[model samples]
Structures are given as structure tokens and as C-alpha cells.
Target: MKKIHLVWSFFCVMYVSLAIAAHAEEKIIQGKEEIEKSICELNIKGQIEKEFHLYVTDGYQEMADGEMIYFWGFTHAKDFADVEEIKTKAERNAKLLPLKVPGDEIRLTSGRNYVVVLHNAGWYETEEHSGINHVAHTIHFHGLDLIPALDGVPNLPYPSVFPGEIYRYLLTIPEDIEGTYMGHCHVDSTNHIMSGMYFPIIIEKKPNEIYGYTFDREYTLFMSELDSEYMETLREVGDIRRGLDWNSNYFMLNGRIFMDNLTHPLSTINDPKTRIVAYDGETVLVRLLALGYEHIFAWHPHGFHGLVIGTDGRKFPFAYEKDTLLIGSGERYDILYKIPDFSSKRKCLSCNYGPGISIAHDHNMKGMVSGGIYPHGPMTIFDIRPKKMTP
Candidate 1:
């Protein structure tokens, strides 16, 4: 394992300063529209095309232990014509959404042209020798078949998208392609994606419909693993090569570790967009996407089994039922969970224990802990609250 001291040494001082500075930061978690605006990176969606303005910037996520793990991610660019104007917590919080590790959710429709504009705004942390200041980034649409021109492999065309510049991608997704997919940085992908440059992408057959099934609502769980020391090395010297010392010690679902998920403002359970909430007799669609250096996540829901509907943006001809779903690096699964009518004891067999609170955790033994601490890795919930209750 990477020396723990090096990790915290970089974080300890930053946390003290960033924590105080972020106190007055503006948070967009109030109104419904504002919340959606914060979580979704898609800027515009037309009938024939969807447009996105993604800003490549550096940010930090405070781990369960209060250590801020430095990462590079994609956030929404409020203005299509701006670059690297903000650096402080207050400035970033006011002007841009703090970058999430798995970036942001982008919903797509089958057979539509997608226009993605990526602006390399720049990094925030000014650690000398981090090599972050001179780096170029690109977004490779994973699990999607696109031409070499539209595909985002670096140097395939030229020097790549550097800071203060923007790259435009005109994507055409086939009509029959609709399922769970992802977009991530391809240049030094091992370092960038592990440092938090990926995001969830869902291509639907149509709105709220997939593979001839409809659901009341949907949630996405972006699973990832991070080694604070590994990130420290990246931010210290921008090492793109994989090292034998690499040890991913923090496992996450939607950016935050477990236990923290129960309370963190940006966690899976607290984030209304990601928390699996459903009324009785309704179907809930869950898009599970994962990435890690060497981790396999066995997703285990406590009470009910989910119907495995799709994978890697392809619909399954025959759906299967699985309670503990296994996910590997770069894999995406679309699962449909039909919440039975819990008002009646005989409504559906095996759902007798649901409708209140059900814990969904990573059964991959190692994923249950962060930095070797038990019960602190990826864990979330499926809640069916009182119909009138509000967050």
C-alpha cells in the first residue's frame, strides 16, 4: 500500500483552509430546477440533437476521514465562452458546480445527434511540479461505437485540447443502441479516470422507457475506487504510468464513501437524483456504472432482486433476476426493480421485507471498507418513505 502519511500530509493543511473558505460558498441544492441543473451536465437537449458544455477542471472530494482527495473532473461550463476565471472555493461554488468524481449525469435518446463541447478551463490546485498545469484532456465515449474523428483518443488528430481551449464532438448514436454507457478521459485514462474524470451516460429508447418496460423514476450509481496516495502522486508529479505501489483504498458509489452516504449532501442516498426512492406498485430503473484499477463490485441489495434488463448500452432479449449483481471495470448494467405493493402482505413474494428501508451494499469484501476501515466503503439505500414526506 502507498504510504498513508504522504496522502494525509498533502490533505491536512488543504482541508483546514478549504473548509473555512467553503463556508460562504453558494450551494445550488434549494429549488427543484436548480438541483437538476446542478446534477445534470447536459446544457441543452433538442428534439433532433443534445448539446453539452463540459468544463475540465480540478477539484477535491473530502473522504469519510475529512481528507480532501484531489481529482480532475468535468463540470458544466456556465458560460460557453469562458475559461479558468475562478480558483477559490467561493468563486468556484458561485460560478461552477464543484466537480464530481464520476463527473455528472447525461441523459441521451436513441438515434439522436449529440453535440459535446469540452472546455479545458484549467486546474485549481497550484502544487508546484504537479504537472497538472500543462496537461491536455479528452473525453472518450466508452461503450459507444463512433468514428475515429469523433472518438476522443489523444494525439489521434493533433496536440489535443489544452487549457484555455475547447474541443467539439459531434456524436451520432445508432437508433437501436440504448442502454447504460459512460464518457471518460482517454488521455492517460488510467490516471485521469482513476483521479475522477468519468461520468454516467444513459441512452434511453425514449423518455422513461427502455426495452419495452417503463419505470416511475430512475437513479444512477457510479461506482469507483480511489487511492489518496495514488492521487497525491498524480498531483505531485502527474505520473500516468501504473505503479506496483498503486493501491486503491477508497471505494465509492456516486463520489462519497458509505456511512457518509447517509449524511453527505452529495451522497447516493441524499442526492434526490441518485437515491432509489419509489412508491409501492411502481418500477424503479437503476443504471449501475463502475470503474476501478482492480476492484470487482458485487452489488447486493438487501431485500428484493432486480430484473437485469441491459448492459453496456445493449438491451437484453431475455431479462434475468439477480440480487447481488457483479460489476467490473468499465462495465454498466441497467437493472429494473419493481417495487411491489407492500400495503398487502401477499402482494409479491420475497418482497415482504421491503417498502421501508433496504440497504444496498458492495458485497465485494474489499469494497466494504475504505483504507481498511470496515463499513466505510460503498453503501446506499432503497427507501420507500411516507408518501407525504419531503426532504
Candidate 2:
């Protein structure tokens, strides 16, 4: 009788343990499913470790009137916490987002990560009849066009005061495809932008898919512009005005030129005179976001049209092949292509798009022109090679 009682107790304990384990697994699975949905949200917050400055140029200098502008352009961080690890006030910020979704009330622990959903992650909307809204609403700035457009917005009565404060949204990432994604303010402000305000965020994919290629390897590059002339115009206008829209003349990938230049000596070319990443593989996905006013991005791989796998954050069933990807303003394209099989004119694989596939650039015929004396600004390239050969 005693032995039977002990055996029964042991079985009951085992059963309870299994039930708890099963419940935990279910919660994790649910988290992953919620994450896979199209719109991803991240609860982002930060602390200004010190008196941090927002710059518009790559180089750092004070304007003649004495405003600190980063040399070349603005200086924002790739990650929020790199400046200072702080808690996230996502719910507080979410109130400002236009497209609110159905979900539980969530609070983000400052340093810890959390998940949310974006009903309209990349969509832009104007504020109400408020002064800020009227100016931001009067014009729609995309990619590099802000430098010129912001000129028309109401300016500060004093030079020492900024025209208006820029506002941004906060979100969280579900656990499925957690990694780095890029975002920027979608308004026009050339000098303000080049000063340094763009940044990147991480989405923690659900545990099961945390490491695998459940989807595909992908990245997003935001292209924008800044203008000294436009900044001065805004300073002069002192109030919002119509008919101020100008095509984006400057361009940048991430924040700098996309070419392979250590120091961006040339300012006329939008050609990002720097390189971002090394891309050599069987399948590569490049997400392109055009934030300028009215330029079509003719993104062509040097030797390939790059397969079109997705658009505006939505995946497509069939791939569209083309030499130049004509992306309109406020558009996003997900491109995929394989590494070159053979060489072109030179011994090594080149970055040109005619026959051999090696490079990527904008096909906005006019955008290829230099900004004033400088070349286009945001042009970038991904060097794709086999993983085995990567140094």
C-alpha cells in the first residue's frame, strides 16, 4: 500500500511539471506568430547621455550665424541604447501614431526589449490644424527633398531658436524576424537632416526562428537629401507658404554617400562615396526606401536588375527582373539577386549592370547629375561575393 501511494504521488508531480512546460511553449509560439504579421512595432526610448547635439552635416562646424551642424550631414546613432540605455515609453508615444491596432496594453521596460505591431509603419500623416501640422501638411517631403521643402515651413522669429521641433513614433518588434531595421523622419529639412537624426532598430524574432532563414536575409537603406540654400530660405520665410516644393537634389544612403570614399571630399555627387555592407551570396534581399520629394530611384545592380521579391513591405509571389528599379517617392522595394557566375571586362567581378553583374546605382537619369558641383548624395552599393571567399 505504501509503495503504491508513493508511485501515485510521483506521477502526479510529473504530470504537473509537463503541464507547465507545455503552457510555456504555447506562449512562445504565440509570440512568434504575432511577430510574423506584416507591421512590426518596437518600444524605443533613449537617454541623452550628455548634451547630445543633432547635426545635419557629416563634418562638424558652427554656421556663420552660429548653429552647430555636423560636417557633411546629421549624426544619429545606429542603435538607440548606444547613446544611453533607457526605458521605453511606447504606450505614451503610441497615442500619437495614426493607425492604432488591436492589442493588449503594453508597457516597455526601459532597458529590456518588448514587442508591438505597426498598422501603418511607414505611412505619413499631417498633424491637425496645429502650426506644426499646417507646415508639415502643406508639403510632402520624401527621401532627400526635405532640405528644400522645409524652407517653406514657418521659421523661428529668432535665429537662435529652431523653427519647430521634429516628432517621431515609437514601436516594438514581435519575436519572429528580430534584427536591425532602419527608419527616419519623413519630412523635408536639408540642413536639419544632414546634421544627424537617422537611426536603426532591432526586431527580436521569435525563438524558433531566431537564427534560421525562416524568411530571407534582408536590409533597408533610407535615401535622403539636405540643402544649405533651402535652410536659409526657411529662415527667411518666417511662416509656412505654398509652392515651396522642390525635387530632391541631394541623396544619401544611411547618412553618407554610398561609394567607397574614406572622406567625402566631393559634395556634388549623391553617390554615397562610401560602402555599407559586403553582399556575396546565393540569395540577397535589399530593401530600398525613397524619402525624397519627387525622384524615381532607378536602382540597378551593376551586372543585374536584382530580382524584385517585395514592395512597400509586402512580399510578392513572382520575382520581377529589371536593370533599373524605378521606385517613386514614399516607396519601398525588396530586391533579391544571386552573385555573378562569370566576370565582365576585368579579371574581377565589376559593379556595372549591362552584362556582368557587380554594382548598384540610381537610374533617375537626372539624379545621376552632381548636386551643384557635387554628385548625387544617397547612392549606395552592396558588394556580393560567396561566403567562402569573403575576407
Candidate 3:
């Protein structure tokens, strides 16, 4: 009877502890709130078709290991809904965002004139950039057809924008060119880009429809890596004076990594910007952007194959199918993935497994490893569901 009582008490204690821990975890929400809209509003307070007020600065992204990695980024400063809201220069400083790594994804319509007011507010030392540096920064529109003047390269004629300086980049997107693109810091391209000063630049024929193709859903798998040791050196010295040794360890998909990335709100399971969700027979367009300094990102899906329709923002005349895709730095690939519908039983021999997940991850060992852990980096998922199962 005494032994029975002790066992009962032990079970009760275990149950109570688990309950307490559950309650504690319930209060902690993973991932940040969707600060920027999935696709930002266009024609925001400008006479042109689209105009962006961007603020440049620094911020910190807390990695899966709880390490706060410092990054340089751009954030939407002003989306002046009303003309009355447009005030002095100080007003633009109100919505400065420096905490995000990839910056805001700029979506533009084809055959529309757009302008970007690039304001260099310097490092992320403080929310308000009181102390500025001489280091210049510029936006190099990778894979986008642009003139040398707007190229964002540091040269004698068109110098990169420095601290406390603002430069306006104007471009008219041609109807012929509309697809995946990228924008990054061109000044000290090696150091600046690797340090996390980049974002996806996608020009669409419309919203979800990319000219010849239409997608039920879309996701941007922006692939990049972090070298903690190299970053640490830059963090301490304020710059990479010794040149890039090129030792990246942590690989990420849309700024999140590993098992934590799979469950975290900032992941494919949650982040609106990179969630791979599709119903039976639905098509999901995945824009693969490799922005890292080194390596070829070899990615593949577990259950199904993807149709490679475009590369580097240009649609190919013929769409080819591939189970695995290899993309290099500064490169982009647009692949269309069609979910096998459960209703179409003849087509889905694999659907016998039923509605489940298909892990889309980098096959490259470097992409899958970090700090001696297998399957620890650059992973996302494709949540496929039956017609009845989907909400």
C-alpha cells in the first residue's frame, strides 16, 4: 500500500510538472508578427506607378541557437496612404526597420514605372541613426536588366550612397521582362551582401499570375548562409579588413534554420512569405533565390517533382521537369510544383500515403549541416492536403 501511494504520488508529480511546463510554453510565441504585408501595397503616395521609401540600417536576427547575429538591411519607411501624411524628413524616420535580415521583398508590376528612395541611415547602433559612418551602400539589382547609372556599383562617376545621403533609383519595368530578381548592397559586395544586406526583387505580370503561368500559391525560398566566426570578427572589428575567408556554417531558408525553423512561426509551417501550402491539384510557384557568397544550392523535394519554367527572372520557352535543382549565388529559379490531387486516383499512386508533408530541403551537405548536426539547416516543407482535409 505504501509503494502504491508513492507510485501514485510520483505520477501525480510528473503530471503536474508537465502541465506547468505546458502552461509556461503556451505564453511563448515563436516567430515575429508579419510586419510587412505578404506583398506590399503599390502606388504608395507617388505619382509614378510604384514608389518605395526605404530606410537602410543595421539590426540583429536571433539564430536558432539564441545567438543574435547582426545584419545590415532595408525596411519600408513610408507608405503614405494619404497625401496629408507626407511631412518633413523626420516623418520618414518613424517607420525605420533594421531588425530583419533579408529586408522587405519588393514586388513590382511589369510595364510600370517605379522609384525607390534609398536612404542610407548608417549602422544599427541605435533605432535613430545619430552617429553615421562614411561606408557607402548601394542596391545592385541582380538579374534585373538595368543601366549602369542605376547599377548601385561604387565607381568614380556614380559613387555609392554614403551615410546621411539619399539616392533615388528609377526604373521602368519592361513588359517583356517579368520574373524573379534580387537587390543587394553592391558596396564591398563580398562583405556587405554576406553580412545580410539583400532582398528579393520580384516583378510580376500581375499579382499571383506570372504572365504565361498562374499559381494558387507562391513561396520565396531565399537561401543564404551564416559564418558565425566570420560575422563575429566583423562584429568586433566593425568591418572585414582581413578579406573573406569564406567559412559559412549555418544555412537558412528565408532567414530560419533547422528543426526550429520547421516549427517556428518564421518557417514554412508559419511564415506567410515562405509557407509551402497547397491543396490537391493546386499549383505552388516557388521562387528560389540563392544570395549567399559561396556554394551551389542543390535543392529537391521528397515526394514530387517541380517544373522548371524560368531562370534568373526570364521564362523559358519550354518548361522542363526536375526533381532536384542546383542554383548558385546571385541566381534565381522559378519552379512550378503541382500537388497530386487525391481525387485523381489514377495519377496519384503515391497519394496512397494520403495527405501529408513533403520536405523540400537542400541536398548539399553544407546546406544540411551546422555545428556538427545533420539535417540542421535550410529546410522548409510542402503541406499537401486533400480537398476535404483543407480548411
Q: What TM-score does each of the candidates earn?
A: 0.79, 0.48, 0.78
Estimate the lDDT of model 2: 0.38
TM-score of 3: 0.78
Residue 38 Cα positional deviation in candidate 2, in Å, after optimal superposition: 22
Q: Comparing candidate 1 with candidate 2, which one achieves the higher TM-score?
A: 1
For 99-150, candidate 2 gives per-residue lDDT tens digits of 1100111222223333211111111122233232122211111221223212
Q: Each model's C-alpha lDDT?
A: 0.76, 0.38, 0.71
Q: What is every candidate's alpha-carbon RMSD to the true fold?
A: 14.6, 19.5, 22.3
Best by lDDT: 1
Clashes of each: 0, 91, 0
**Residue-pair clashes, model 3:** 0
Which tens-of-lDDT digit does each residue in 93-140 have in candidate 3? 455543577877888888887777677766644323222234678888
How does candidate 3 score on lDDT?
Answer: 0.71
**TM-score ranking, high to low:** 1, 3, 2
Candidate 1: stretches off by over 4 Å: 1-48, 78-94, 260-267, 343-355, 386-391
Best of the two (1, 3) by TM-score: 1
Worst 10 residues of 3 by lDDT: 29-38
